[model samples]
Target: MSVWDDLVGQGPVVEQLSSAAEGTSGLAHAWLFTGPPGSGRVTAARSFAAALQCEETPRGCGHCASCHQVLQGTHADVAVVRPQGLSFGVGEARELVLSSASRPTGGRWQIVLFEEAERATERAANALLKAIEEPAPQTIWLLCTPSPEDLLVTIRSRCRQVMLRTPPTAAISEFLVQRDGVDRETAEVVARASQGHISRARSLATDAEEWRRRGAVVEIPRRLTGVASAVVAAEKLYQAVKAEAKARTTELDEAETSELRHALGENAKGRMPRGTVGALKDLEKRQKSRATRSERDAFDRRLLDLASYYRDVLRLQLGAGNDLFNVDLEPELRTAARNGRPEDTVRRLNAIMQCRERVAANVHPQIAFESLTLALRTG
Candidate 1:
């Protein structure tokens, strides 16, 4: 296996990065990786970093010690920056620039892989732009964002861009079966359900609770019989998604707090020094922002699932031959199509999109979801 093995359906990108790693043409000091969510932007960057540091011939030999270190995020020369809160600020960017300016410890390139680069505040981005503009002889920057427009025009113009596409359902399904040993039928179902999101498909294939959560979401349309049911459904969905998000983040938050307390001279009884309270409070504030973002993102996934259900109904109503995203709910979708007009399905979809936008804008989730469910019921 090579470093690019895990990057499903990104053959052209793999080729381009491999050639650069081999000291061929298309090499650049700064690279921008842009792709939709779950398109493996960070994965591609990390793989390229590994290849650049690999000790074996052909650059990306997966078994080499350097390749392993980079892939596992233990390489001294590679720094992976993942923003923990809603925004990355100027202070953190300054620290990053300082770290990235250092020469490589292992005689290879000093690599900085910045994931979610779009989350950088304007000041932070300006700091990053300066870093990219001024080159360290051994430094390379890998920036990952959803779109080139997410970064400053100067930064975009400075970097070589690698665009990743959503992998085909067949590729994801085969990968699940071959790599994870999932049953073929189950793999196919999750593959189609994920809508070309490789990580999501893997989770759906392996995580029983995730499959169950999706089931609950797709069933919401059928339960929207009246205003009361709609309100109740909305509340339930909101609570479930919130709980999932909290579950995902609680452990990380606890670990971070514990580490900070120890760094602040906490004793066996967990008491800290004077003036440490302020630092703890700041960490708490950042953790809260991260939790809020996680909840919003989780709820948005549920909304997309709801949208898929309505889209399936619309497809059936219009006699479109396209495959349904909710394949297991085809019968229920057919019933929905028979009972509703295509126009109504379109209106419900619009409402779901509106709710997603409102939630992203920081509207209270319960209020947004409630409004959405009422619209869906009426439609």
Candidate 2:
């Protein structure tokens, strides 16, 4: 086994990283990893970090202690920077530069794996550019973003780019069955439904709630028979998306709050010492920001699922005959296709995309979904 095992359907990426790990060529102080969501961009960066710090031959040997530590995020010389809120500010970037400039305690590379580099603020990006421009001898920076255009051109130019493709449905299905012990049929269903998103495929196969949520989303098209039904559907969809987002972040938010309270000398009854209000407020602000981002992401996924239903209808209308994402809902899709024009399907898809843009611009979720549902109903 090797650290690259978790990276599905990325043989070329594995070859490039492995060769670099072996010090043959293509090694650089800064590396940029770009790909679509669930395409394993961060996973590739982490695996490369492990390979660079491997303790055995054929670097990234999964059995080695260094590899294990790196994979588990406990390695002394490797730091993982993940933005907790919507934006990573300049203060964090400056601190990261200072921290990463130090020599490695393990006598190897001082590696910083930065996830969602696109979320860095303008000033933060400038700070990062300076660090990348004159990195220390043993320092290596690995940045992950959805696309090269997300980052400043100068920063990207200085970094060697490693582009990862979305894993194929067959590869995702095989991985689910072999690694997660999912049944072949269920794996196949989720693999196609996920549309090349490996993480979503695994979640759908393993999590009953995730599968149910997706089912509800894909069924929205069928429920929009009238204005009243559309309005009700919009409210329900908004509530469900909000609940999922809250469920995902509530545990971590509570844990961080409790940890911070304890660190600030909170008594057993949970009363904190004096002058701790500011810090608690800051933590609360960050948590709120994180929750907002989570809710937006959940809504985006639901929108995409809705779009896939219309996509299948469009394909049927056009005689495309391609594989459908919602294979289980074939009858519903066929009915929708038979009843609606391809132009209507296209219009509904545009409405969903517009709703997504509105939400990203901080529009109220209820307003966005209500608008989207009405458009779908009319279309």
Candidate 3:
């Protein structure tokens, strides 16, 4: 299939990118792809990069060497910069700028795809801005972010903007069934629960553990019966989240340590080099920072899931007649709506959102969760 096939419910974006790949009127030296989470901004950018490098008659013929190479991230002329930590630093951006200044080795346009451009530090943005302002004749840059306002005005000004919309639930369901071989029932459940987040839908559809965790999250509202129960629930949630984050980080941490040790020429019998100790310490520090960010992101997602359950409850209470994201939990949602006042649901939603803000502001997750649980109990 074509690289564009994976981009669900973005037909207009596909058409624009495809036409540009074919040397149509909308072609530009730089492009900014903006969309909400899971809108496939990065996927669209990669597909466009592949199409640009494709040598086939229609362009982006999936079987062509250029197309395959770009899609597989093996193309010499293509570079993808993804920040593993919370933010992209000036050092990394400068290196990318230098790399993008070089001519393409494959006799086509050299493409640089930067994901999460919103995370670029001020210095990093400045570095990127310089490159975009005076790009190499054979170079192209594609930056992906949640929105245009998240990027520097200067950077946004120099690039052609491409906006992507959330994929419909039906489209997500179909893609899961066709591409991932998921059962239709499970696919639909995950798609609706994801609320247009393709990645979350895939995870929920394929991972039993994720489904179980979400089940627990949706039950939180019903479980907050008193202050003691709320505290216990908050503790449980925090511990579970931390455990999951640790499980995800452990293997990556070990691999990174091994790689760093090897790079420092630390073998089984060799003594440590003079500066290797400091280098290893720095690497560990960075790894810790990345792990913290990962844990925060995981916790934030759990908060969002919690909020969605209450949102469904709120919708039911207000007779909004909107489709519920957590359809499987509708009975519980209706029970809560009937038992609690509409104002209570709104307060709980506000509490969850405030917890998210507190966590983002570096408050202890345990404290934030505990506060949120109590708010739910008393709201």
Which prediction has the highest TM-score against the true structure?
Answer: 2
The C-alpha stretches of model 3 lying farther than 4 A from their native spots are 269-271
Candidate 2: give its CA RMSD in angstroms.
1.0
User: What are the TM-scores, per candidate, against the unseen true structure?
Assistant: 0.97, 0.98, 0.97
Best by lDDT: 2
Off by over 4 Å in 1: none
lDDT of 2 by residue, 21-59 (tens): 999976899999999999999999999999999989988
**Candidate 1 TM-score, true structure as reference:** 0.97
Ranking by lDDT: 2, 1, 3
Clashing pairs in 2: none
- Candidate 2 lands at a TM-score of 0.98
Backbone clashes for every candidate come to: 0, 0, 0
Clashing pairs for model 3 are: none
Q: What is candidate 3's lDDT per residue for 24-140, written digit by digit as tens?
A: 766799999999899999999999999999988788888999999999999999999888888999998999999999999974899999999899999999988989999999999
Of candidates 3 and 2, the better by lDDT: 2
lDDT of each: 0.92, 0.94, 0.92
